[model samples]
Target chain A: MDEKTRRQALKAATLGAAAALASPVAAQMGGSKAQPGGKQDPRSKYPKPPFKSQSQPWPGLASKMNPRPDHGDTSYVGSGRLTGRKALITGGDSGMGRAAAIAFAREGADVAINYLPEEEPDAREVVELIRQAGRKAVALPGDIRTAAFCKDLVAKALAGLGGLDILVCNAARQQSIPSILDVTDEEFDRTMKTNIYAPFWIIRAAVPHLDPGSAIIGTASEQAYNPDGDLYAYAQTKAATMNYVKSLAKQLGPKGIRVNGVAPGPIWTPLQVSGGASQGKLVTFGATAPLGRPGQPAELAGIYVRLAEDDGSYTTGNIYGAGGGQGQP
Target chain B: MRLPLRVLTAGGAALALVAPAFAQGPGSQRTREFVSASAQSDQFEIDEAVTALAQSENPDVRGFATRMIEDHRKTSQALADAVSRSKLAAPPPGIGGDQSMFLSALQSARGSEFDRLYARQQVLAHHAALVTVEVYAASGDDPNLRAVAADTSALIQSHSAMADQLAAKMEEGQARP
Candidate 1:
């Protein structure tokens, strides 16, 4: 790690965020055009995917598709909700991870993200966004399949960012199977290790660095409560994740670390396109959501910021449903 | 393996864009000679990935470098074994001109720039190698090299996939906020 380069990147990132957060001196506070006021249908933004099916090999590429999933690259406008905080988000390369990271940096937190070693390109882009927000950004890649890597994931962020205040276990892998009989031992284990095991490993590693005001947010899914027949393994892991949040919250409450989970309904992420869901599933993805469309990643950023903030004091152990009126617990 | 190469593949465009370069595959002599050069390129990437492991703060790139070292070594050995199994003459040492150009440029890069350049090079080199092996696998005069190409093409294609993913993510950072 070049200390000078790291420092420069951080400095550059902070300046970038500062510029985005910078308000025009002449602007009024009541309600500008920047703030949408009247009737607006959130569902009307981006068009849904058509009947076509797509897949990229493992490690999943988000850029190859024709519609290209919207990662909040331009839509998310940040308020200074998490200034100077330090955050480490696993899977921060794309989808929810990327969206949360962009929001965190814009809110003034120095951010570090982790992803699969193969997702470095996406991670680098997130790092650039953080640095653009003028916040320090670092991207780490690793498989959370092992305890050692999970420990190191936190360790690296602590070492790189100088501390850790927010730990978001948002990276997960799901390979949908038609029947329980269709599940291989390895496949079941990978789903468990990535979704359930890794969160435990990461939370355990991140605990020591967290203070009373610190937040640890894990991503659960709408499937936790209302799972489809084909997603037994994934649903089981998510349910476990939700339960784990409650258990950890009970354990960590005395220590001041707020543990929570976010359960997204159908949102357009590489997960669906990358075999987490079937090709048939991708076509109707969020169609069942009450909103009648899949949620965008940008839609989840506010809840993430809220949970990670120092003053988000009232919330803990509870799962926030950012689902488009989908299942909730 | 430099800027434009990385740029081309960042969006999963590597296979489509570089497919043409290997459409005819290299000539028979070049196909026979490719193993030595490909092995050298692996060494080149290993050397570069090692540098990333040591210097990159980004875990993603560091982890990728580790994979590069591990996977390339295994494939290199596989190729060497394939060569030994057949009557093909031993390839000369040290790498070809284009690979050297890539390595020299990689040697000079640092920080995120280094990560970017490294991933780009990996994407280019792997795709080219895939094309080379594929060309030979599909049409080589040497039965042995063709078998080796057939054996190695899958791994090379996978490497290209991994590199393509890496390049894709790195491109996200390039977008002006």
Candidate 2:
């Protein structure tokens, strides 16, 4: 195309995207949702696909996301499944972490959340949601890549929430490098430190404080079983997490503490736009899922809440999947 | 890094873009400056890509050009949203500072000359963006902008590596007298 033609093409492309975005989302599939921050019916099916591929900066902002990934602000309908519990959720700023935070708080748990300093906006939002649940909420912002920070985060969570009955290693980082050669040293280390190392650090620090009946849920992924060729490091760490979760479940079971993993499929989250998936992959994300659309954060909150409560009293060493029928068991 | 918004998020010095606007009065101005600089870079790349698509027959250059247009458009929208929320002036559509000269040179070039020129800027711009976003991420006055800068820097670092490889290949092709 010539300059004039190319300019016209780009102009059309921009306008087209803007035009589509201008259309308002029809109220959630089953009807308009209750004012967010409160509960609605648990079975209300939210809208699917046609979500904006908007990316926020690192540790991306949930608020900025177009049609923001619903963090169970509505449609959760907590049933006091976890009354009087104290929980610490890393990466509770957004995505599954945010959803679980909301579920836990509404289920009657005092909550402490740790996330990257960059995610403070999201953490603040989560804190507000938790406070709305009539539960104590504290935001502990810092990097999870360092052991010192991980230990410090646990201490702060313990201090803020009084005692921690649920320790969720939910924070993670991933980048798609197609070729092994494209994986840089810094990139590899960051993936490891985030997806693997931080879990170890947080678990080690929290183990001493955890009593029997405490739940340690690590956010392993379906990638552990079905690895993506581009996400080499991420898949590797996720695989390792599956093993670690099982091993912890066995070890902690002797102490009445349960360890488990949740393998989420292509849940729509800031993680995708933040380089969790290659851009091309994002163009058709979650299409192959049994369900045509990607899973939302709200879908996973109930499971997290269950595992942390008496509902999961006997569930340990199991990898519960919210993977939309992809990786079962 | 929208400083005014960041300040509001940080719960201090709300939107006070007073005189000495560029000074460190809680980072709103600095955030605006960062956003403007980033917008300038995005526009420069988009213009260069448009030139490449129009003039270059090389499939590689065209592909890279397509990517630049798409990537910049998405990011620009986000930045535009930030600009709107910040109530800051939207940056004019052009290159910043001496970058206009590069855009001019790109507009006039053709064939391998255009290829070489485009790739060189890609290399340089990617590197500059990597550094700029990294600096802002590390110590930018605003917390929110710092996150954007950090995310953008990671992306730029990836793009820079690709541009570096392309620059080397284009330079090799240019050597064939």
Measured against the true two-chain complex, the DockQ scores of the candidates, in the order shown, are 0.01, 0.01
- What fraction of native interface contacts does model 1 preserve? 0.00
Predicted candidate 2 versus true structure: per-residue lDDT over A95-117, tens digit per residue: 99999998888777899988888
Q: Which tens-of-lDDT digit does each residue in B1-177 have in candidate 1?
A: 456766756757655555553243333666566766667766656655655654466777877878888987887777777667764555543445566446435543455666787789888988887877787788777666677678778878887898899887777766647
Q: TM-score for every candidate vs. truth?
A: 0.59, 0.59
* Model 2: how far residue B119 lies from native, Å: 26
Residue B63 of model 1, lDDT score: 77
Mark the regions of model 1 whose C-alpha exceeds 4 Å error after superposition: A1-39, A49-51, B1-177
Model 1 lDDT tens row, A33-121: 23323645566555443335677766686656445566655445565678779999988988898989988887779898888878877
Interface RMSD of each: 22.6, 18.2
